[model samples]
Target: MNFSLKRSLTFTIILGIFASCSTSTEEPWSIEGKSDQEVMAIADSLAKTFIMVDGHVDLPYRMNIKGFMITKTVEDVSVETTGNFDFPKSKRGGLDAPFMSIYIPAGYQETGGAKNFADSLIDMVSRLPVTFPTMFAMANTPADIEVNFDQGLISLPMGMENGAPIEDDINNVKYFFDRGIRYITLTHSKDNQISDSSYDTLNTWNGISPFGEQVIAEMNKWGIMVDISHVTDSAAFDALRLTKAPVIASHSSCRRFTPEFERNMPDTLIYALAENGGVIHINFGSTFLSKESRDKFDKMREDLTNYRAENGLSSDDSVYTAYANQYAIDNDVYEDVQKVADHIDHVVSLVGIDYVAFGSDYDGVGDSLPKGLKDVSTYPNLLNELLKRGYTPKEIEKICYKNTFRVWRKVQEVAQGLQ
Candidate 1:
């Protein structure tokens, strides 16, 4: 536009990029003899000072299900609301970039409108910046998030939670990339045409399907990060094998804690991911954290299922629904924020600090989030624990945003070479 404005914008973008790419230059501090209050203050300051990037947040789908309209000012998200991620809460949490998941549910595949549904969610995300330009910005790249970070705006980058939207067409990969999907979790609760889901017993494709291989290739060529969060181990390995770029477990925890949960990545996958120069963003769900929570929570659900089977009850039967609801209420062992830190610790123990970042499934995880991290405003608590455990400022910075940014930039670099 004008000379002065152009110069100002350029300066802002450059400054933001520097912040996103580098750790703080302030004299490094130690935690050897510090009191809890001192470490907590440091964590608070770092939380604000650093650029935090959550690899997955389901705000788009959360709003979509509520019939939120682009034309209306949604006070729930615009200001303080009960939801896990409102602008004020995110700002308070120092969450500069949260990738909004355009989750196409597994049923969408059978319903035959997966693509259209995904488009609707994308439109919802696109409308965010339009509706709140000063508070939110559409981020298609790490650079965009950096710029937004510098300008005191939150960046709403997007990732598709399932590949169902790709449908039977491979060309849709580029089409979605154009729509600003930076990553795609290949499958959800059931095996899809793209890849087998971890939750599915059928193992339909046995791994990435024939077309699934093409989808990964096309995505890599177009700079999309292949996400293996909910895919079967075979499919995840298939993606790791075929993708030309690095990958991300956008919202998964380690299976080392919950040995029974296939949804969480195990040591083999974590090591493989690190070898690919990828990052595994830790999920903050209670169920994803520890065995204690899993036993107390998941076992209740299993018992409910068995009870339903015994009584010849459908899952949605009023009697069964009542029992399941009460069961959930009775067993409320929400693993604390310490468990979240433990997941992060486990990942770092497996593959160093560079391979771990946050992908808290806020708004997506329902009420199963850990105590201290129940919403976007409690990152400091997690950071405080990490500081107590001897994570330095630079290491905390890496966990906050740098690692994810590194993988993101590398994914783009690979795309450049392929193109």
Candidate 2:
């Protein structure tokens, strides 16, 4: 990747003039408790009191794969059904803004319809408020989320999961921003025209490619927060160094717990990222929350692959599903709600309380979600854990929303200067 001196000089000058973002550590109230029921009740009430912001949620992509379109009424999402999130659950959990992810699978990197696919998901999310006027609204800014919260409505903000949709055009960055995409993860499961992914071995762009660097610069210019969740360590470092504004790892966890996982942030990277004023949102999935869960989960995949190969079973075979379910039951691979708190505590220990938040991958992580936090309604349960850990009400509120809004507002402010 080309790290040109001209770009470096220009970026430094811009950074000098930009105002730093304020992350408030304001604690509105303090709590002291003993009963588990009392603690749980406080958690439920706190959820309603704070403005919660999940950095990423994959509802649009989840709906897309199932050919599920959002209308005035959708069973799984609008009402409480089987999915991890639903309107009723969100209301009960006090989720104010869940950034609806526009996820582009790695296969689209090979084909050429990525942009079209992303637009479709965007449309699906855009229609939520149109169909259910009282329940949802598309949030373009932190101010929008605040207004929506006051109105007792949920904000559906958009963040594209891959930059393949941006393709080779830097102009497309502005195009998506116009369409309400406030952030973009440079790459997904595989490297594309942008950066190399943590999951892919090729390391196509050893770090950010020439184009990836340009993409980050453009994203900074346009106020789109760069997401570094699925990028390799080299790529993560490159983007962290290159961008003029704070970035977010939308749904990543601390690698301190799951040492073998490349997708989560290690101590060094988390330190650097927090130093840059970014926040790492803890994922609620079991595999991301615990190393033991990751180990057992990996073994299950390996065993299932062998079982399927030997039986010549199709991917959709019922027997295959049954075997996978049985394996999960036997291995006991799930973590509980406290594990989520553990990840949050890890981030707090490395960085301060100002840079940690929630980004439950919700409907995206499937059935492998942690036991107590299996769905959106269980956020209060996680909050209950944090309370038990001695988190102040104000500190819990910061994790719930303020840290993310700090980054969100600052990214926009930086864009204003660049323009």
Candidate 3:
């Protein structure tokens, strides 16, 4: 019990306490001023049960087209530090379930595109049990989605972004069902075999194509949720009238906010979606949210396309993005994450909180997200912001994940009824 011995013990105890304190205060990002501990603390204190169900992800191209693999860590897709999503980082940020999109390029819409793309997407998703065993698990049903979240694994649900892959055939929907695709977007950037598109120059189908109606019937029978994100207004209306089950806009915003954007769902359509028991999963893209941002980005893209055509590199695939990034960075074409919350607010005010969800276009449009909501991991920040905006825990839960799952369950019910 000498004084020297007691002093040594006291110093060791103090040092241990300091070390423990430092470890608890580590931050997730070095660039952001807020520490990781601070972010997690705010998230935890809010008590806003955030089961984030991200509605869309283009995994087919990121893996197959780019030959990239998603291991159980962060991936740096390009020279830019803020590009691509990091798994461990996402989990740390509390993103519950992310639906991985198996998107097929529009080239396949003509002949065997639907069957070929559907087959490939199915094969790729089906192999996850063997390929990345520990990292991913498939969720074919709404219940399975929640279960995966409880088990602490990301539920990589399947969503097809274009019916072009289905070609002119309706039976292909059944084939897609067997392949485990739960949802399918009717069109992409261009009008496919099934319908007209919001982004294309085609006036072929003023709304939905003749084949598109057949596709909807087949989708309902097969129990696949129909996604109407990029479809034209006529196509969207046709889908509402044709679909027996609820449909979803996997990633879209209210056109009411931005007047002329065909990509956004107008108030009239929002009313229809809400009445049909569907959800309009808000897109996290900066351009989709802000008209100013969208206009600027589109101009940049057009300039790039013109530049490439003027030069001999029009056919060079790499030239498009090489020019757009510089344009984006130079013009500061980014929206505040609050804009996301604003869209959510608009949806809630229009259709109530039950028909809205998050559909982050991660990897599909990298560097096009709002400020604080850059990657999958930054979801908690969005939740924190939502909390600050006076959203209750229950409302937040519905917005975060429950609403989407509810629609999913309904879609399943309608499918079951067909049989």
User: Which model scores highest in TM-score?
Assistant: 2
For candidate 3, the lDDT comes to 0.75
Better of 2 and 3 by lDDT: 2
Error of 3 at 267 (Å): 0.7
lDDT digits (tens) for residues 249-307 of candidate 1: 99999999999799999999999999999999999999899888878876876898799
TM values, all candidates: 0.86, 0.89, 0.81
**Top candidate by lDDT:** 1
Over 116-141, each residue of candidate 3 has an lDDT whose tens digit, in order, gives 76677667766755565555578888
| Model 2 steric clash pairs | none
Candidate 1: the clashing residue pairs are none
Candidate 1 Cα lDDT to native: 0.86
Pairs of residues at least 3 apart in sequence or in different chains that clash in candidate 3? 27-36, 57-101, 114-165, 114-166, 207-235
- Residue 132 of model 2: what lDDT? 74
CA lDDT scores, all candidates in order: 0.86, 0.86, 0.75
Q: Write the per-residue lDDT of candidate 2 for residues 98-205, one digit (tens) a residue.
A: 999999999998988999999999998998888777888999999998878767789999999999999888899999999999999999999899999999999887
In model 1, which regions exceed 4 Å deviation? 1-29, 67-78, 299-332
The window of 10 residues in a row where model 3 has the poorest summed lDDT is: 72-81
